[model samples]
Target: MGSVVFSIDAELGWGFHDYSNPPTDRIESARPGWKTLLEIFETYNVPATWAVVGHLLLEDCNGIHADHPAVDGWFARERGAWRDRRDLRFGPDLVEAIAEADAGHEIGCHSFSHVLFDDPRTTRDIARAELETAIEVARTFDIEYESFVFPRNAVGHRELLAETGFSCYRGAADPPESRLRRPLEKLLATIDPQRVELVEPTVDKHGLVDVPPSLFCFRFEGMPRAVVETLAEDPIVRQAKHAIDRASRTDGVFHAWLHPNNLQAERDARRMESIIAYAAEKQATSDLRIETMADVAERAQ
Candidate 1:
C-alpha cells in the first residue's frame, strides 16, 4: 500500500496578509471553509494534518507575546496594521473547534505570526524565538504538534526545526531534472500533477522526514465562469486521480495540500469534494493508505 499524506495550512488571515487583497473579516471568511473541509474529511474518513498559526490558538495576542527584536522589524507594518483588528488576525474559536472535532486530524504548528522561515532577514535567534513561542503556545492549548508546515511553504531554519523537536515538515516539490521538461513541469505543476516520481517521502540532512507535496489543491474560482466550470468538470480532478494511481502503483507517497481559504468558495468546495471522494475510492479498492504528516514521522522513527 502507498501512503497519502494530506495537510492543510490553517491560518485565518495571517496566511494572506502579504497579499494585495487581504480579507476584510478573515475569521468570518474562513469559518465556512473550515466547516466544509472538516465535514469532507469526516465523510471520506480522511485524516489531515492542520498546521495552525500559533497566534490563532489564542483568542487574542493581548498578553503573552514574546518580542523578537531582530525579526520584529521584518513585518512591523503588516503586523501592526492588524493589531487592533483581532478578527482579522486571531481565531481561538476556530482552534477550539478543530481540537474538539478530533476526527483523526493532527494539529501542527504554522508559526506564531506566519513568519516566512526562508526570508534572509529571519536570523537563527529570530527563528528560534518564533519556534519556541509556537511550541509554548501549543503546549498551553494542549496541542501536540510533531509535524510542521513552513509559512507560505518557505522552508528555512530546518536544523532549528529538528533541534526544537519537530519530526517532519512539508518540503517543496521536486523539479524535473530534464532541461527540456523542467519548464513544462513548472507550468504544469501549478495546475496539474508533474512530480509523481519524486513524491516519495525522504529524510533530510538533520534526519527529519521530508514529506513533499504531490499537487497543490489549486484555486479555480478566480477564473472566468466558463473556465471555472470546465476545470470543475475534469482537468484538475483527473490529474489528482492520476497522481494517486502512480503513487499506489509505485508504492510512493502522494501528499496534497492547500490553505483553508482555498475552500471559501462553494465551487471550490465542491471541486475539493471530488478529489477527496476519489482518494477514498483508491483507499477502498487499491492499496492506498491515508495518513497525516505526524503518522509518517512516527513510522519513520
Candidate 2:
C-alpha cells in the first residue's frame, strides 16, 4: 500500500516578516480558516504535520531577544511593527487546537523566527540558536518535534538539525531547468492538470528522512481563482486525486502541502476539503494509507 501525506506550513505572520510589504490582510484572513481546516480533517479522519514557527507558541514576548541573530531591522524588535500585533504573532491557541484535534496531527518545527537557513546571514551558530529556541518553545506545549520544515523551504545547516534531534525534514521539489517550464506547467494545469510527482522517502547522510512534497495545494498564479467556485470540478483537486491514485498503484508516496493562509478564499477551502475527501475514499477501498510526515519517517526507519 502507498501512503499519502499532508503537511501545513503553519507559520502565520512569521512567514511574511521578511516581506517588504507584508500582506496584512491575507495574514488576518488566515486565522478563521485554521479551525475550518481542523474540522475538515477531523471529518475525513486525515492527519497532517503542522510545521509551526517557534515564536507563535509563546504566550507573550517582551518584544526583543538579545540572544537572537542580528538581522537588520528585525521585525520582532520593531515596537511599532510588532508590539500591537500580538494577534498575528502569537498563536498558542491555534497550536493547542491542532494538538487537541482527534485526527492525530503532528506538530513540527519551522525555526524560531522564520529565518532563512540558506542565507549567508544564518551561520552555524545562528542555526543552532534557531533550533534550540524552537525545541525549547515546543516543550512548553509538552511536544517534542521529530519533523522539521525549513523556513521558506531554503534548506541549509542540516547537520545542525540532526544534532538537535530532528528525525526528518521536508525536501524541496526539483525545479525545471528552463524558466519557461513553470509558466508552461501553469498553463497546462489550467486546461488539464497532470498527476503530481510521487516520491519514495529516503534517509539522507544526516540520518534525517527526506519526505519530498509531490504538489503544493494552490491554484496557479495567473489562472482564475474563482474557477473552482463556478466549475463542477477544480483542476487542482483533480490533479491531487490523480496523484493519489497513481501513488496507490505504483506503491509511491503522494505528499501535498500548503500554508493555512492559502485557505482564506472560500473556493480554496472547498477545494482542499474535496482533496481530503477523495484521499479518505481511496484509503477505504484501495491500497492507499493516509499518513503524517512523522508516520512516514517511522516507517522508513
Best by lDDT: 2
| Reference-based lDDT, each prediction | 0.75, 0.84
Residue-wise C-alpha lDDT for candidate 2, range 1-301, written one tens digit per residue: 7989999888778888777788876688667767788888999989999999998999987767778775766654335576788877899999999999988999999999888889998889889999999899999899999999998789999999899999999997545442356766656744464646788999999999999988888745334645553775677788888888887787799999988888767777888899999999999988899998999999998
Q: What is the C-alpha RMSD of each candidate to the true structure, in Å?
A: 3.3, 2.0
* Model 2, C-alpha of 284: deviation from truth (Å): 1.4
Q: After superposition, how far is residue 237 of candidate 1 from its true place, in Å?
A: 1.6
Residue 96 accuracy (lDDT) in model 1: 75
lDDT value for candidate 2? 0.84
Error of 2 at 88 (Å): 0.7
